[model samples]
Target chain A: MPTKTVAGVTVDVNDEGFFTDPSQWTEEMAPELAREEGIDSLTDPHWTVIRFMRKEQAEKGTGPTVRGLGKTSGVTVKELYQLFPKGPAKIAARVSGIPKPRGCI
Target chain B: MNSQIGEQAATAGQPDPIEKVSVIISQGSLEGVYPGLIMANGARAEGIEANLFFTFFGLDVIHAKRHEHIKVASVGNPGMHMATWLGGVPGMSSVMTHMMQKQIAELDIPSIPEFVEMISDTGAGMYACKASVDLFKMEKSDLIDQVQDIITVGEFYDIAAGGHIIFT
Candidate 1:
């Protein structure tokens, strides 16, 4: 288990940079993680996706698939790419401090 | 450092092509189609262009009337965890197909038709192999509307050029 220092706090992360213990995630770390994912800033729509993903993970024990997120997160898939770039689900999950969404290959 | 600069200069004239993924679906079983569909959709989710080519038994997946009828192949499927002889029993395949469908439904996964529609809606290209179509005597009308066209293997390769090609 590798550890990363985000926001002056050490947290475990997997080889792919996904948080090993999602419970250790903090709101303050979101922006740092977002920047690391290549997004310069988090807009309201971005927060909407992050918050929706966190809520889904808390209830479902895993983040929603990209299709499910697009359908339910009030953000369309096209817009999700605009916000998160190359890999929305993985990037969003990392920024939200959750495991990669199920069925994301 | 000189080598690095040379390498950069060698490639500076042209913009990089958009990342693309080409998936070949060769089997028509429930298990086979889902992986290809999932992968294509995954590529789209990753903002990569994706194309799915159906050939051989995979043509069943694009058949307007048969796409929905794909069944799980339990007979001789080592993953079924049963006696090898039992797998050959009649009706077992259907039972296994139903079981798999139920499991997928429980996971909130869509059916094959619906999954195809969803992937197509994502701008993923769907194609059928011309060789398979000719061998099976299938016409363009036999395929789902989502299919862009029936293309030869050479054309498929040409279109899939400059991208990762995955066979499932």
Candidate 2:
């Protein structure tokens, strides 16, 4: 049994060993970040889009395009600003637990 | 261009001089599963300690339900038709992905689950992207068995920074 703790979230992994909540997710669950940072990371539209990306990634294991994710979630890119003034990559990085992707870093 | 890909141990703090392979598995789909899976597997057969990471769509290769159902492309993908006998049209990536999947499959291949098993059996490193896990709302329960760790892209790079990185 292997276990990792991140941001007060304890992830207990069994012998097969899977991460319950990927440890990198800290101060950035979108929802959690908003509550603590007073920055509303997961706005309605952003939530819609991120949830969609998450679903796609979970089922497919790949990230979705910002435009594609927006289209599916019924939100315009303009609405996304309220959540992540930093743009999609930041939100994607925060949500994906990726700490910003190749270009951003 | 008679260059043959090769590998040799890189001295600490020095880059690997050989053309080593780093495999990123991004699709959890049946069709998208093989490239990363088998390529990592094949690299290992050649004695390379490949780094296999599963991200976004590629994570399906390591998930429970869809691992074995992973399939070869058959549609608008232009994958089914033979541009040449037993291979795809020249210079197209889809063809290569398709052919590689088949070649690996015919070699008494295993499903994505089985492939991961073999990867472990061969001592290759395996990781899953953390951001994708959070985005996908996947509990650790969502991942397949044998994933060594869940890391952010930064963490993955901390490992990948040393070797050749490949995205499939």
Candidate 3:
């Protein structure tokens, strides 16, 4: 999956067909792929982190590195990855309700 | 039965007849809790009788002591970088919960404790699911004092069968 736009903001969704704008993602569509799979619902940190990833994607046309996001947030890369063991791309992709970003494994 | 109320005018050529609605919320996650409570409170605001059934994990919302401790899950969510974006969101899980609680507070939305209080105040009926209680090993002592009954699914159905059924 590539970047999709909603309200003019392009977000990076991944290959699982996960990252699209929420407007394009229906309630039924979201839960079918991403409910409680090693993860529960999107929490406050999720809102923060995913929004950060989208902002990065918007500015750069690609998702930022976990290290980059972590560095910016002033937390260690280990902590970032620890927080998102599934990786930021997959997590952000799911919450944005878009397809998996291309090249996500 | 908002729909039934809507239909009353069509059938009887009168204003909607004292329409009522009931909702049952089964999930207990922080995110899942408020929609049910808000809907019930909103219904009450409109003077529609709303009943809420708390079951399974949703029990946390109505718990006397656990009410304030309800937390949001951020550890392994999709878009896991929420902390990076928010720049230090505070009391997010508890805070958001409290903000919602505050809405109920200001609007006088009831706490699990207060909800029981207002059920009497507003004449709304509240109950706990007996099977869930047993499954969770909870007793009446575990619940707030206001629960009208510890009911079986069938018991919930007895009261909820005719009205609108909502599972949040």
Candidate 4:
């Protein structure tokens, strides 16, 4: 129910800053959202993860967990941490305009 | 009510999120080993630094030859929903372990060996107990390559300082 302005576009988000309705997200809004997580810019590898996350969430109705990302995202687990910093799966889901993944691992 | 309090505190920035965890696995049964592994993996998933210390029978979980073959305890486990005597029957342990493995696989949970590799790749530390290693007459080479070292309880405490310590 909470809305925030990112990239001059208003989007609904939860208390944790994850998008509540992913449909409202646009590619242009990602850089600003990534900044909120202390990432100054989105590089090629970051885009790779973000794109993979969006596709997975769109197909599965939820984002993948870290293990799933490591297994299938074409990105290794160590690389994910280096790209997304703290909490790669959760952060990637946020930047990808998906709700937080519900899996524990 | 507790959750509400936590939310309020979070909003006020009164407490920090958990930044680290140390999990001690002291048992070898399939069920016994999972809780610690799951917790350690979950911590790393959340970007929390995690360490797993395997001691006593828990070393079976890291043994080069036995790690992949650890079995669920069929006998004397009331949670199995069967008679204790029936569980003691020959082949019961294997059957139950197979069934449990299938169920875990269905849930997308990794097997013990694969899970360990995944966790290790996430930068989570894995160590074996020095006392337990000596008791079992195992050299460092006997453990899987992922284990960082054989360490004493004091060393584990040193690493676990300023974090939650969980014994399973």
For each candidate, give the TM-score of chain B: 0.89, 0.69, 0.69, 0.91
Which regions of candidate 3 deviate over 4 angstroms?
A1-105, B1-18, B76-116
What are the RMSD figures for all models against the true structure?
A: 5.5, 19.3, 19.6, 3.8
lDDT of 1 by residue, A1-105 (tens): 899999999999997788878899999999999999789899999999999989999999999877788778989766777787767787899999998876853
Q: What clash count goes with each model? A: 0, 21, 26, 0
DockQ of each: 0.32, 0.01, 0.01, 0.73
Model 2's alpha-carbon lDDT is: 0.57
For B1-168, candidate 2 gives per-residue lDDT tens digits of 223322223344465444456788776555566667667755554445578888887776777775655555443455456444344334444545566667765654554575577566555677888988777777667777677888888887888775688887
Residues B1-168, candidate 3: write the lDDT tens digits: 999977876788544544566777677655567667666654543346667788988877667777666655543444434553352355555654555556655643334544434333344567888888889888888777667788988888888866787888
Docking class of 4: medium
Q: Candidate 1, after superposition: displacement of residue A76 in Å? A: 5.4
Deviation in Å, model 4, residue B45 alpha carbon: 1.3
After superposing candidate 1, which stretches have Cα over 4 Å from the reference?
Answer: A1-47, A58-61, A74-85, A94-99, A102-105, B1-19, B76-78, B81-89
Q: Put the candidates in lDDT order, highest first.
A: 4, 1, 3, 2
Q: What is the TM-score of each candidate against the true structure?
A: 0.72, 0.45, 0.46, 0.93
lDDT of 2 by residue, A5-104 (tens): 4456655543323233334354344465344424544556556665665566566555444334434556644454335443443455445443222220
Quick one: best TM-score, which candidate? 4
DockQ of 3: 0.01
Candidate 4 chain A weakest lDDT stretch, 10 residues: A78-87
Give the per-residue lDDT of model 4 (tens digit) for A1-105.
888998998889999889989899899989988998899999999999999999988899999998889889899988998897678899898888889999976
User: Once model 2 is optimally superposed onto the true structure by TM-score, how far is the C-alpha of residue A86 displaced, in angstroms?
Assistant: 46
Name the better of 2 and 4 by lDDT: 4
